[model samples]
Target: MKAWLLNDFGLDNLQPGETPTPTPKPGELLVKVGAVSLNFRDKAIVDGIYEPASVPKPLIPVSDAAGTVVAIGEGVTRFKVGDRVNSHLYSTWIDGAPLPDAPAHCVGMPLPGGLAEFMIIHETSAVAAPGNMTDEEASTLPIAALTAWYSLVDYADIKAGQTVLVQGTGGVSVFAVQIAKALGARVIATSSNDENLAKIAALGADALINYRKTPAWDTEALNLTDGLGADVVLDVAGGDGINQSVQATKAGGKIAQIGFLGGQTAALDLMPLIFRQTTIRGIAVGTRTSFERMNAFLNDHVIRPVIDTVYSFDQAREAYEHLTRGAFGKIVIKID
Candidate 1:
């Protein structure tokens, strides 16, 4: 089988070559991949910016994919051969509760991931794909969609009539807007691009802020809520945006910190946090259980993933480059 292997830490070291096909061990499933999706984390790992749970060389580097089961190991009763499935990005975190430590046995980092023709997944990590989605659409669910679902639904518990603010038009933010709306929350999306903002509005977002035009988007968001601020803020921007998120959140509101897309480090003011009793929670990818819940929601609501583009399996490097270039939605790789 041909797989894209990372011989060293840099993107320059990524090369395509033949590798042995993996067989399923007990409690594992061997999937013949149909498609794989790229996330910002993939770019970070390739650029040596992401540090895995453990240090090693020669890693297969992508977590999110959709495939058909070709074989299943002993004790695997949830699925069978010929079933279509997707693996959760964080394979070891099976529930919504916080892990005992950082680096929760993440796929594409410590473990071999989905960037190959054949990949093995534990039974615990597999979830059925949503009924209405194509393989390309289903591939985007494991990382971005699951992360958004965990943050908005599991952590924040955003409810109907609540105002939820989502930052930017990245993969997670797009999913956040959709899921928040699906949960009966009023969604407010922010984007630097007018085109993307228009697209977000079409996806049931009640309000849209062009962050570029309105440099003080946080204040505008507050004003839109009648000076009360949003009930929940899904924040992907990690630096000074944290301070903005805190300020834009209403008293006792929750902020789910999900990524460092803006910048990793930031100076924070604790005044709003102390006075308003704000709750700021850090969110990792998600648990396998959350992935299952998200799949159920997708199937019930007929939610479809937004894909920016699709690349052939052999064009994996180009797909990675496209993600780094800030594609508006999820980038997918057709593996079969």
Candidate 2:
């Protein structure tokens, strides 16, 4: 089988080559990967910003993929051979409250991942692909879609008529906007480019803010909300952006902190959090249950993932480069 292996913990070490195909262990399934989706964490792993759970060698490099089951291990009954499936990005975090030790068991970091022709996953992590989606669309769901779903549906409990603010036009933000709209909530999307803003509006965004022109987007958002601010803010931007996120939310509103795209460290004022009774929750990629719920939602609503571009399997490096260059949607790599 062909796979992209990290020879070492650096960007320069990510190289494509051949590797032996893996077999399913007890309670695991072997999937013949059809497509793999790239995420910001992929870049962080290659750049050595996020270290793997343990120091290892010859690591396969991706977590999100959609494929058909080629074989099943002993004791597996949830799925059979030839079932179309997408596995959770973090296969080990199964159910209930997140374990304090989750970071150590994440896939793509410590464990072998999907950027290969074949990969094995525990049967507990595999969920049926949404009926209406293709392999390319399904590939985007395991990480980004699940993250947005967990934030909006599980954590924030977003309801109809509420206002949800989605930052940027990246994978998670796009999914957030679509999901919020599907749930009957008004969506406010922010983008640096007017073209991207226009695109977002066409995708059913109630309002669009060009952050490049309106540097004080928090004030703009507040004005849009008639001084009440948004009910729920999906804050992907970090650093001083956290303070801005606090300002953009209504008193007693929620902010789901999902990423540090702007920067890691931030100078934040705790006064609003104390006095205004604000809630800020940090979210990581979701568990298997969230992934299953997201698929069910997509199936019921017939929602499709917004794919920026599809690259051939041989162009996996190019796909990673495109992600680093900041594409607006999911970057897909087709295997078969």
- Per-candidate TM-scores read 0.96, 0.97
lDDT of 1 at 269: 92
lDDT string for model 2 (175-245, tens) is 99989999999999999988888888888899999988999999999999999899999998887888888
C-alpha RMSD values across all candidates: 1.4, 1.2
- Candidate 1 per-residue lDDT, tens place, 227-311, comes to 9999989888899878888988999999998899889988889887889899998888777878888888877887888899999
Where model 1 places Cα greater than 4 Å from the true spot, the runs are 52-55, 101-104
Best by lDDT: 2
